[model samples]
Structures are given as C-alpha cells and as structure tokens.
Target: MQRNTLGNTGLEVGPLCIGTSTLAGFTETYGYDVDDERAVETVLAVFDSEVNYLDTGNNYGKDGLAERRVGEAIRRRGGLPEGFVLQTKVDADPVTGDYSGARVRRSLEESLERLGVDHLPVLALHDPEFMSADQDGFGPGGALEALVAIRDEGIADHLAVASGSVEVTQRYLDTGAFDVVLNHNRFTLLNREAQDLFEGARDKGLGVLNAAPYGGGMLVKGPAQQPKYCYGERDEAFAASALAMAEACEAAGVPLAAAALQFSTRSPLVDSTVVGISRPERIRETLALLAVEIPPALWVELESLRPDARI
Candidate 1:
C-alpha cells in the first residue's frame, strides 16, 4: 500500500484506515457482536498488513471498549508498528452530556488510557452537533480551546473535526484549529453531500477521510439485504438506483462492494477511506475488492445512477 501525505500533519498514511466501531461489539448498530478475542486479532492483522491507519472513538462502545481492544493488540505487539497512524475522537459525557473544556481534556486522557498510549497522532471532536449551542464546546474554556491546548501540550500531535453534519464540522473548521476533517456516510456512491466540504478541505491543506463507502451496507449488501441508506430510513429514489447498480454489477461480473469501496479510495480529494471491519478475513476480502477491476462501461452506468447532483 502506498502512503501519502495527510494534508499538513506531516504524517504518512495508507489510503485505507481500519475502523473499530464494529470491533467494539456495537451490535445494535452494525447488527453483529465482536468478542474481545476477535477484535484484538483483527487489529493485530491490521498492524501487520500494508495499511498503516486505524481510527477509533471514545464513545464507540460501552465505556470505551473499542479503544481498550485496540490497546490490547498494541500491548501484545509490544508497540505500534513503525509509521502506523492511529487516531481517536472525544465525545460528550455519556451520562451527564457534558462537553465542556474539562470534559474534553479528560476525554483525551481517557482515550489515551484506554488505548494504552501516551500520545495520539490525531484527536478529533466528534459530533459537535449534539452539543448545545451554549454547551461550552466552542468559546474560551470550551472543547475547542481544550483540544488546542492538548495539541499545544504535545499530547496530541494534530487535531481533527469529525462529525456527521457538514455545517457543524465547518463551524469547527472555520476556527482554523484542525489539521484533518473526517465525515462518514456522506461522500459515498449514493451521497455526495460532503463532496464540496472535502474539496474545500483539501484546498486548505487539511486531510480528508471519507467513511462508510457502502452507505451503511446498502450498496454492498444490496437494498434487499441492507434496506437502509446511511443507517436510516431508506431514500426511495436512492434505493431504486442502488438496485439498478447492483444489477449492472452482476452483469459486469463485479461485486457491488468493489465499486463502493473503490469509489472513495479512487477519489482525488480524499486522503483516506475509513472501513469498519470485525473479522480478519474481512481484510483479505477488502484487499481482493481493491484488486477487482471495474470496466469503463460499468463506471459509466454507475455514474449515470449516482446522485444526479450532490444532494
């Protein structure tokens, strides 16, 4: 896997980043449970693979279980692999809903403790939209200030904005505090909502990561299997288009998963694509998907069905 410059952060990472949300056993969301053994093995496999990036979040599981699982793998391996880039996020308090400056600093401390590491390559502010306007996440003595202080203190080398909403993320970006910007379920084959946001970030020299290329599984599993788009109510027109693309992929002797995964990996504006994996075999499958060749005609057909315009 070839590594590239991640904006101006000065860290090199492969195009594919392993996501640990599923590894945390978020069965309610991903519809499956991943035991600790499985989760640690998967992370170990990732460390030995060509890919050099991994992403996690503070609230990914019950009491930050995901970070602990990844940390277990690191402990077994003695330390992180050379040149590997690991990033995690800060979330509002699960019980108190506190997203204050104090909470922000504590979140990084907690994540570091869970991951069994002293430092992080990147620390992101996750789901700022969930924090109330006056929740102390932006002004002085707020989350943003805390994150900047963490970076300045050399606890986290870089800061990032990670959110599901473009508006909320842009609000943080406008503060000019982040070196990377990550968004999920927005720039996939069915949705181009983050296209403009990512393009602008690249222009500003910020690393951009596009996550959930399968639109939360509908594109890869077929609308019949995954029924929803972006893990929510199905968009009727988008579902119909997904069906058409699935059929076209069948005719082209290609798996829809390949097109979906490559869609983000092939984009020029994206520095990395984050993919959730629970099993080690999934990594092998991902490599095979990356190797699958898509015909030009197939791209033409898929593009015809893509969100006619960025919605």
Candidate 2:
C-alpha cells in the first residue's frame, strides 16, 4: 500500500500496479481467460488493497473491451479513489501493424471513449518494437505530436512508451517527451538488458514501470520445459539455472510469484511493478505477499541464483 511518486509526472502511485492485459483478451498469449466479472472483482480487490493504479491498453481486445471493463468496475463502485490513477497503452493499427501519428491519435480517442473517461492519467505506446520503423512517429508532426496535443487538451496527463528492447526504450527516452517507461523482459533474472534502460529512465526522471517481472510466467513456473520464445527455449543449462533460482526461493521460504513481484520493486530504478491477474483470489495472494517483507539474507540468496552467477 506504499505510494511512490512516478518520476516527475507529479502523480503518486502504489508500488504494485494492476495490469489488465489478460482481461483485454491477451490471455491466450499468456495462457489465461477474459472473464469480465472476475476481472472487475480483481480490480475492486486491488482498490480495496489500496493499489489504485490500473494499467490497460487499447489493442488489448477486439476494440476497447478491456478499458470498458475497467471503467465499468470503477463506475460500479460509485467512483474511483480521490487520487486513483488509470493508465493505458495506445497501439498502432492492429491489422497493418503500423504505428503512425494518425494511428496514435485514433487509438487515444477510441480508448477514451471505451473507458468512458475524458482523459487518462497516463498513456503509453503499447509496443516499442512495433514502432521501430516509425520512430519518427514520435517526432514532430508524428505520434508524439498527437500525444502532446492530447495532454495539452486535457485528454491525457502524461505520455510514456512501453518497450521490450533497451534500444527501442532509449529512442523514446531521448525524445524528452515521455513521462514514464514500461519495460518488459529486461529486468528479469533471465534477462537484465532492461537494467541499463532502467538506469537511463531514472537519470532522466522518467517513471519506470517494470512489466513481465516473472518473464511471462517462465520464472514463476521455472522456465518452460518446452522451447518456444527466447525465454521458453532455454537449454538444459538455462533450465538448471532457473530451477536453481526457484530452489533458492523455496529454501528461503519465498514463493516464486512473491519473489518476482518483490524483486522488481526492490530496485531503485523501478517505481512500480505491474502484475496481471485473472482471478480475484490472485489479487489477495499478491497483497498478502506484498505485506510480508523479504529478509535481506534471502534477497542475497535470490540474487546469487541469477543466470550469470550460475555459469
């Protein structure tokens, strides 16, 4: 329930943010379901726990179904907390996969309508990699222009870029336009490339929101036994390394999920760590873990199990 100021955005948010990617229909990719009623309950549980920052996106579903669900949940509860903050991502066209300035404007307008809000607290570029060719989209007369316009018009309070690659993240940071940066896969025990980006964001005074702290569940389940994405295709050496980390957590009496969430927030570079939940009970479990402080000795043990150290 502790709050931290997100860089210089002047907005205070809880250390734990509720991510709505799964509720928006990205569950198959993460292996979950889009149960609206349950999702609403989870959001409510988050509020009850004093974690009011909710992260979502425009491209989360067929339209803005995820945003709508979030809006409905807040509305059903009478209203959000006095200072509750809602953040969401805006993506380029889902069909063409182009991230142009026009697409950015269109996406934001659609998201606002879906969320039933005139303005959003934070608006992040959904996928940085997808906008590689359109880095100019964030330049003058580009998507950045639209984002700035939205903020100026009171449709958004802050702008941010959520990316997987450190290089892509740097491009946005250099622009001096974004107030936050949501990073994925970089700060995990499996991949630390995002560590550099985190440093940069902190130095530049940009709020750092670490996503995929569990490496898309790989860390939670101890690296998928089967190969798929970069993290999933871990060879015996990598699997052994990940298992060792899991064992270390067990030996230290820490649940893998709890370790993942706590580890991400422990870093000074991370202002908040977003956790995606499909069920209401998961929210309670996360809150319980957050309330328990991890011993320093246990943290050192967990750090020692990092992949680089195993080799």
Candidate 3:
C-alpha cells in the first residue's frame, strides 16, 4: 500500500496501477466482458484500496468506452480520491488510423471528454512503432510535437512513452522527451527484452512502468488455460517453457501469479507495475499475491529455467 514517487513526475503512486482495458469489455481482445457496473465497482475498489493509480487508453474500446467507464466512476465519486492519479494515452486516430500532430491534441481532448476531466496528471504516446517517426510521430508536425505543446500548456502534467517494442520505446526515450516510459510484455519473467531499456530510462531519471507481467496471461493461467504470448497464439516451445516454470513454482510452494506480479516490483528500476483487473475480487486477489513472499530457493530454480533466454 506504500506509494512510490514515479520518477521526476512529482506524483507519488502505488507500486500497483489498475489497468482498465478489461473494464472496457474488449472481449475479443481481453477474453472477457466487464459490464459498466462491474467496471465501476472494480475501479472504486482499487481506488479505495491502497492502490492509487489507474491507466487507460484512448482506443481501449469501441469508441473510448474504457475512458468513459473510468470517468463515470470518478463522476459518481464527485472526484478522485486525494493523491489519486489518472493516466491515459494518445496515438493514431481510431477512425482514420493517422498518427499526426492534429490527432495528438484531438485524442487528448477526446480522452479528456471521455474521462470527464480537464487535465491529466499523466498522458502517454500509446504506440510509436505504429507511427513512422520520420513521417508522423516524432517529426516536426507529429504526435510528439503536440504532446510537448500540451504538456507546456498545462493540459497534461507529464508525458510518457508506451510501446510494446524495445526498439520503438528506446527511439522515443532517446529523444529525451518523455517523463515516463512504459513497456508491456517485455520485461516479464519469460522476457528480458526490456531490461536494458529499463536501465536506460532509470539512468535518464525517467519513470518506468512495466505492464503485463503475466506475459499476456501465461504466467497467471499457464498454457493450459491460455497458450498465448503477447496476445498471439504461442508455439509448443513457449508452452513447454511456461510449464517448466509452473512446475518449479509448485515445487517452491509459490503461485506463478505471485512470482509474475512481484518480478516487476522487485526491480529497483521499475517505478510501477500496471495490472489489468476485471472483477473486484481480482483486485483483492492481486493485492494478496503482492503480499505473498516467494522463497529465494524458488527464485534460484526459476532463474535456471531462463525462459527468456530460451523462449
């Protein structure tokens, strides 16, 4: 429940951030639907709990439905709790798929409208890899330009770079333009692709947010329930590697989910770990997992697996 300052952003947030993609009912993508009542309950539960930060995106639903759902919860509460921070993202146009400077501000405006807030303490560029830097996102009249302008205009307190690829994330971080950097499905136990990126961001004093510690739900559900990696179908090797880790966890008397959630938090370079939650009970479960202590021997055996090196 203790809060950590998210790098130079001057905002103190809980180590666990509530991710809202599941609340948007992106069933096709997230594998489940959370109705509005359930979404509001989950948001309020996390906010009322020790967790104090919530993350959503502009394109998280059919038409920014995720932001709207979070906004509804905020409105119902009359405002966010003291010290609570709300974060969202901007990127290519949902309709036109154009990643332009105009789209950047327009997206923020749309997100603000959906979230029912005037300003955001945190806003990130959703995915720069999808936007050719030279042509759209990092150029003169691109998304970054507009994001900086908005930050200077006091519309957003801080800007962040959120991407799935290390190369793309580093490309944005190299510019020294973001206050925070978020890499998803890369720094998990099964993948160390973002290890260097996390180090680089910490060196530059930028906040680092590691998301999807479960590796697209593999560490949480195993290959039997979900045989996917980074949202795509995984091969036999990937499944076998996950099975090995699960067996080791079982032997060590630790839950795979507990190890997965703590893996990111244990890193001194990681400022926050964002986790997606659907039901209110899931929030309680995650908090309990965060409290569970994994034995050193378990870590030793899990390290021997080296799924990142193999798969």
| Cα error of candidate 1 at position 204, Å | 0.6
C-alpha RMSD values across all candidates: 1.6, 2.4, 1.5
Candidate 2, 54-117: lDDT as tens digits = 8989887777777888887878888777788888888988788767778888888888777777
Evaluated against the true structure, the overall lDDT of model 1 is: 0.89
Give each model's clash number.
Answer: 0, 1, 0
Segments in model 3 whose C-alpha atoms lie over 4 Å from true places: 132-134, 308-311
What TM-score does prediction 3 earn?
Answer: 0.96
User: How well does each candidate superpose onto the true structure, as a TM-score?
Assistant: 0.96, 0.90, 0.96
Local distance difference test values of all predictions, in order: 0.89, 0.78, 0.86
Predicted candidate 3 versus true structure: per-residue lDDT over 1-311, tens digit per residue = 78888989889988898888777767766676878898888888876788889999998887898898898889888888888889999968876788889888888989999888999999999988877544657779988899999999999999999889899888888887789999998888777889999998998889989999987688898888778877886656667787899999988888999998999988898989999888888888998999998998887777777665564
Clashes of 3: 0
Q: Candidate 3, overall lDDT? A: 0.86
lDDT of 2: 0.78
Better of 2 and 3 by lDDT: 3
Q: CA shift at 262, candidate 1, in angstroms?
A: 0.9
